[model samples]
Target: MIMKYAILSQTKDLMPTLGLGTWQAPPDVIENVVYNALELGYRHIDTAFNYNNEQAIGNAIKKWLNDGKGTRKDIFITTKLPHVGNRASDVKKFLELQLKMLQLDYVDLYLIHVSFGFHCDPEKFTPLVKPTGEYELDMETDHIATWKKMEECQKEGLIHNLGLSNFNEIQIAKIIKEATIKPQVLQVELHAYFQQLKLRKFCEENDIIVTAYAPLGSPGAKDHFVNKYNYSPDTFPDLLGHPEVKAIADHHGKTTAQILLHFLVKQKITVIPKSTSENRLKENMDIYDFELTPEEMNSMKKLDKGEKGRIFNFLFWKGVENHPEYPFKLSDDKD
Candidate 1:
């Protein structure tokens, strides 16, 4: 069963609290993954232009529709405006291309993938970086200008709702102060380790629904990315292996991953945990069947290490720290 959250929106839009994330999912396997997710009763599927698998997802959705499993209105599809397409002038063109890739005329929600703008080769949308290894930023591009274009997209029916990802408090506040429509959601790297309590509180106060990506701490994700790049920082502490988490799981007769997901759901935060295994997918969807106690929730809450536990530090975007809107400026440590 899909659990829906009533978010502050232009209309009464009940969004599914659980969604299937498409980041890092291989294009070869993504179509099958999406098809299975739909068959398993997932009503929310999250993707982005940067993910580079929208066409396969679109094909799966097309087949699912043809088979009469569900209608377009039944699913909440979300896509992002990539950092490469971050300029105000490119928003419409960027979204139009994404729509064609997804084979959809309109998306349920559209988001700015990141706050920093990337100056990319216009045709390939490839980031143009300097020889010194810093990202070439569009210093002239501003969030206010980009947001105005996003508002235009909403007014033109290209997107039903608009939101942001990886944006900091000051950035969000600036948008709120100048926006014609408030951001309906904020997607960020949230987990048991880096709980983002302060940011979550801010979003809650402002009526923006928080979607926690990497909600499982994306166990081993650190090691994979770091080893692949030969970078420093140790692997993240395993949330599923934490003694308290495991003990709580045993007490509740649930898996460790289930405990992690349940903890976030109880906090009224939306989650999109990615998995290739069918059993794991079913396990994630079954979170609604059980509940965590107040004590259990508190125990899990203590796992928060504040800014020390963030995993997706965007270190790959060289010199990202120099950006004015860099969200993770609190730490120089990369996970």
Candidate 2:
């Protein structure tokens, strides 16, 4: 049970830079993949309560930590808050459930997933079931209030750091303006297709660290954010197949994914690429030893064409569309 640790600025201190992404990853697959990644020196793992693998993830971490590779302190872990649990009063209850599922005392970083709110219609659906859900914003309570609850958890030692996911500038501004503690990190969708340079700049100026998911521009197809947002990863040539990427892979004797992960880390942006395979998990961790040149970095940066995407924008939580800060915008170049 060896742990991989890389320095990343979480708040005032450095945390492990690379973490395993568990979005949409199934429990059976994630268990082995996580263990393998840890064995390959990956200490940070990213999971969400919505991912439905919290218990499995908790089990894996518990086993690994107790197997003599190291203690929980040696690993940096993160889990996110679900959109349905966005109310101020419900935040702690949701977290407590996640903890019970995770079988852990605390999480390293806890994030508020989704910015504005949710949009849902349980009555008129193919799956037609359950209580109606609405935008947390339209409900009349403030996200800042919910965030305050998150901060209280931080004070209570339920989590080590507090961050946000799917939050936009105005909402982030509100949090920053009213927060007893400003958000330490932000995890967002970023890749060659949608670099989000402007958002990145704002976070950087505010001393907030960013973690880039969807680095390969995937989980974006016919349904979900990739489609609701109208982004096609297939539209962009796979970086793996690019001649420049190929040459670099040959030059460094690494794979394309390694090059991509390294590209982000070199820019000081933490990356959490999701893969449920043992080989891929280990391959991702093998990135720290290499460095790409300034010219090479610029070449990769040229890949931006402005597309926002994700595999799961299922909208099950309801009324997400009304939120001004919904991650994808109608005006974005959806072609």
Candidate 3:
């Protein structure tokens, strides 16, 4: 029973305007969170292989289905392919791994985690840091070839919908021109501080759906995933508490999370915010019945500072250069 979902593209259906991000939550808590989210009417869950918790989500889904609370078809599950797992044979192989871990045959959507392929094999899988870093060692399987395999997976029914994450406009343009199946969804680092208006508009013009992360901006938590590498929010007014956002939150008597979420929902973009706390889980799922007014939405839009954009700084990942999806200020792009 999907209580709420944002129809991103013309095809994909009923993805809750708000879902949970599974970046660094503990596996044990993630299990409980999944069950709690379902109980609280959250019909969507977003996890990735890189998050190292897909199996936990999968197990929880299995239990929910086995207990008759909901069937496997009831939940909207989305995961992604790791850069190291982009080779054709490796993709098929990793897809099997994800399937077995989730205890499900197919996912609602499958995303390519990064727009580039690894520079080496699994045994020698390495990450690149800077210009001096290594590029693809396996020259045969670049990003396009990997995407071709992903397209094959879609055809074989391993994945129902396809998306790309951490990709910039140029990278997406290349894929859009070459791809037989255009991306139905695009996940990017978006927040009140960095609204990515142009990127969002480009995606919308191309009929692609946008998914945002860090709506309230990074909370300055130091973990392996969202480390302290982000530009501090301390200098900037907290988006969740800004007078504008507060006024909007007070308008409907909802929390800042709900307001932040509704802002994106109004734009018809999907959001997946992660929380292990049961109360927060319930609070996050209660946004289906309300809508943000045009005035309020426009007010929030003014909060866009457009400085220090992008939170997913995969400077540690290898083979990120010259492939065209490197998500930084290009020479020609406005700096």
Candidate 4:
């Protein structure tokens, strides 16, 4: 029953490598999902302001604590600053609001949700869009100033660790140059298909622990994007159904997901795969009992699809690729 964890370089805090990802989780169902996860021995919960389910998650954690299941100190909660709150002036305001929503005095980690910013009416909490259906860009969004504010929040004990999501190497380097405290984590899209080898190497050199989102290649994302944004790529990689992965899973007598998760955790990379089923939740955390052989690990490594393997390009934001701080180059634009 040994659980894996990564120690934050700055705070020496232990973050459970396997966390429950709450993105796209329905509000009504999330409370029960989170509570069940805690009962099943999950100690890390990954959420975000834009996810709009923090209150539900908070209620679950509150119930778990009230029932004497666990103390607040036993769980690590990670939330993020939304794109609308990407500037220095808005960091404290949003963090306080998030704290209020989560009913917590402090968060274990707070990440800047993305590198780019968007103009939005604060009351609505949705990005302001132009007549062309594109989000109104906040071109002057300043990463260094925002990082300064995050550092200040860390000093005030509001956030134990500060990190970034959806930020590229160049954007991260800019922050590191001006940071009094460097980022402790970098969460991004990662799976066998899109391993992010270069970025992981860079973060490794900088002592930033990498967390893999969509660790199963996010099988449901294509439909989600199509239904919501009327967009879908010509092709999407299916890691779960891959023949190589299945063969390995069959040999190991484990589920495809367990194999996928173990592959990342074996490399010391963190993974947060989203699922609402009680059985799947329990199944996800069961990877600790087994280990992947080096040959099996390398077999999965060959599945890397590089840039084209990426599913979350943020193109649904409609002209985001044109933004100065857009972290990814379009697949067509790549050499």
User: For this target, which candidate reaches the highest TM-score against the unseen true structure?
Assistant: 4
Best by lDDT: 4
Candidate closer to the true structure by TM-score (higher is better), 2 or 3: 3
1 versus 3: better lDDT goes to: 1
Clashes of each: 0, 10, 5, 0
Q: How close is candidate 1 to the true structure, as a TM-score?
A: 0.95
lDDT of 1 by residue, 1-335 (tens): 32456555655687899999888887789999899999999888999999899999999998899999999999999999998888799999999999998999899889999998779887778889899978897666589999999999999999999999999899999999999888999999998988988899999988899999999888647676776866665556678788999999999999999899888878889999988778888999888887788898899989888788887778778887777777777554433
Model 2: ten consecutive residues of lowest lDDT: 119-128
lDDT, residue 331, model 1: 53
lDDT of predicted model 4: 0.92
Off by over 4 Å in 1: 1-3, 332-335
RMSD of each: 2.2, 4.7, 3.7, 1.5
Query: Between the candidate structures 3 and 4, which one is better when assessed by lDDT?
Result: 4
Q: How much is 303 displaced in model 1, in angstroms? A: 0.6
Tens-digit lDDT track for model 3 on 65-98? Answer: 8889987677888898877675666778777788
Q: Please give the distance, in angstroms, between residue 321's alpha carbon in candidate 2 and its true position after superposition.
A: 2.2
Model 2 alpha-carbon drift over 4 Å, by segment = 1-11, 119-138, 219-237, 307-319, 333-335
Cα displacement (Å) at residue 194, model 3:
1.6
Each model's lDDT: 0.87, 0.73, 0.74, 0.92
Worst 10 residues of 1 by lDDT: 1-10
Cα lDDT of candidate 3 equals: 0.74
